[model samples]
Target: MLYRPKFDDLYRTYTRAFHLEVQDSYGVASENEQLQRFLGGEPTTYPEDWQQWDAFVKEVTDAGASIQRLRVVTEPHSDYTRFLLHHTDRNVAAGEYVRYLPRQNVSSDAYTVDDWWLFDDAVLAFSIFTPDGEWAGGAITEDPVLVGRCVEVRDQLWPLGIEFETYLRGQG
Candidate 1:
């Protein structure tokens, strides 16, 4: 059924975990420290939580599960995007395959919205967020039609995305 599982458990439970990110920014309360540090111009630190997340990614990937994310960002980028770019290195280091696609490059006619996670080509969890970027909840489902759509969307746009490092370098 549809349910919110622990982040680490996502990797453990599914053979493939795919995430699509459409937001220019997120105002998750848990990310406040990192955001503040980023805004303050402090050097990035690998905090304990960061390390744990990294470990989870590595463990999952090492165990042969794929963890991937596709982030669609607008060109000229938002401040939050820059912050996210800075932190993306950690995501890569942790063994997740991260990519970026410029908003202009993406054909809007193909997709209506963003922010969803697909697990094993079955479960789909559409994320909801406040206008201010605060984390809300997800609308989860397991309908085959929706699952097919998620797979199609992932296939169509994922290859068009630039790999994490390549995207950052191009931004410079």
Candidate 2:
């Protein structure tokens, strides 16, 4: 089945959700206002639903499930990446473990190349996106080998990712 990112059903169905984000920019509608603010040198603001989302994350983590993300970023980061970096603290505070891995630091032979989520280490949700960075849709599969590859990629890269706080401080 296909599931949109941030679908409520995801939290209810999976014990853990881990994401790998490889893009430098995402042109999602939700980021429009914030992106403009960021480019205009205004102070960063949390998304409108941030509080509700934070509460949801807290509920999930408090229940012993987890939400972790590893982003592969380019050095001399893109504006969008800087925006994301500035706001990562909010995500961390909300109970998601966020990490950053420099693109140059990742081995080219990595098993999982595209953006995806490994839900409970069982479902591999491959994100399909347009060239302009807009979300097209996503595909989810439970094939054991495919799932195992994603699990392996997570295992290999997650440890190499820098903690959000550390990455933020070093951005200076």
Candidate 3:
């Protein structure tokens, strides 16, 4: 999932948490334990080279490249759908690096990480899977048009800077 060309610029590289490149640890992720579930066996499988995918994410974190995160798109009434925005927002606040994408034109499809199509258009899709086949997902988009819009949103959030806490307070 991570090896796709769409993810090239997003992830840096790696050699002991820095971009050095190696044989075994090519596509490993450095974010945290959550990424482990994404790499687990079946029910959730991907067409791309998982090794390359790991390398890509590891590189990105090592290089300090910005990551754009989107909450899972879902039906407005669905419980998962309702949790999407808040989940994405909370993850970002933790500095794990994420962005809540704009709503999609399509309706929710109930696709899980096991569904390859979910990560099909993804620039970089790295995640963890639970035994029940649920995925702790983090998808990155490299679509030029979408990237531009995401940057705009990030810019709006950037002004809050060290004072984002106060800004969030006001919004509350």
Candidate 4:
């Protein structure tokens, strides 16, 4: 069996982490309640996981490390995506740099790449999800070829992403 390190472990060890998110909707079990609340017009509350993540981001960023996420989303936004957008300010405030890119702006070939996190531009952790968008598992690699490709992808897409605040304002 292959070893899968916890994300917290990875985050702590890496000074720079870049995340590429391509999903319009994610069926994360922990977010189901929050999603329902958002859909029902209830006030937002941070989940434990979200709080912990925010704290981690703050810690790393304050130490001079950086965490950035670029979400490539379809236009007309899925409900789940909207939910994420609504809460993105919290992430930004916690010191994460979040951005959004319209899927239409990218070549179709971009869709072939799975969501992943590149750590210190050396390690790649691919996030696996089931067809229904539920989290499945992760595949981590340090192969130079694969890591190099991911670095190339990041370089290509990073400039294309609009800051989260700017994108959200334009959505109105």
Per-model C-alpha RMSD: 2.4, 2.3, 12.9, 2.1
TM-scores for all candidates: the values are 0.86, 0.88, 0.30, 0.90
The CA lDDT of each predicted structure is: 0.83, 0.84, 0.33, 0.86
Model 2 lDDT on a 0 to 1 scale:
0.84
lDDT of 3 by residue, 11-50 (tens): 4431111110001111223322323333342132222343
TM-score pick, better of 2 and 4: 4
Winner by lDDT between candidate 4 and candidate 1:
4
Off by over 4 Å in 4: 1-5, 130-137
Residue-level error in angstroms, candidate 4, position 129: 3.8
TM-score of model 3 relative to the true fold?
0.30
The deviation in Å at residue 102 for candidate 3 is: 6.4
lDDT of 4 by residue, 93-171 (tens): 9999999999999995754458888999998889877776766666889999999988988899899999998998999
Where does model 3 exceed 4 Å of error? 1-63, 96-131, 136-172
Q: Best-fitting candidate, measured by lDDT?
A: 4
Model 1 accuracy (lDDT, Cα): 0.83
Highest TM-score scorer: 4
The order of the candidates by TM-score, greatest first, is 4, 2, 1, 3
- Give the per-residue lDDT digits (tens) of candidate 1, residues 89-167: 9999878999999999978855548789899998888877777676466777889999899899999999999999999
Better candidate by lDDT, 3 or 4: 4
At residue 6, candidate 2 shows an lDDT of: 51
